[model samples]
Target: PRSEVGDLIVIFRAGAYGASASPQSFLGHPPPIELTIDGDEIL
Candidate 1:
């Protein structure tokens, strides 16, 4: 498989118990966490 390299967007609630939509990217691969607020992605 081609090595997945590049940016990614992860969505979840501000709460600690919210499950991440992109768990594979957020919890796996050691990706950096970027927060999204009010349907807007953090630049």
Candidate 2:
């Protein structure tokens, strides 16, 4: 699938471990924001 700017993409099975494994902070890139959803409700 293709993602455009401002698109909300969901990745399963990613948590603290995934963050530790990624290089998101490399080159000064900000870390990803985490969101929780429950049955159509965004928490």
Candidate 3:
């Protein structure tokens, strides 16, 4: 565990409790980035 302590990882599809799911703007949250990973057209 010490060897991987500095590494940064992202967990996707973990649950529906994500901020971008719903009621985000009402709580003064910024808009999340929408990614379109179509081949090299990753936007």
The number of the candidate with the highest lDDT is: 2
* TM-score of every candidate relative to the true structure: 0.26, 0.49, 0.32
lDDT of 2 by residue, 1-43 (tens): 8899999888776666655567777789888777766789997
Clashes of 1: 0
Clashing pairs in 2: none
Tell me the lDDT of candidate 3: 0.57
lDDT of 3 at 11: 51
| lDDT by candidate, in order shown | 0.53, 0.74, 0.57
Candidate with top TM-score is 2
Q: Write the per-residue lDDT of candidate 3 for residues 1-43, one digit (tens) a residue.
A: 4548556445555466554576767668776554434567875
TM-score of 3: 0.32
Q: Which candidate, 1 or 3, has the higher lDDT?
A: 3
Worst 10 residues of 2 by lDDT: 13-22
lDDT of 1 by residue, 1-41 (tens): 44466745454555654444445555467645555466455
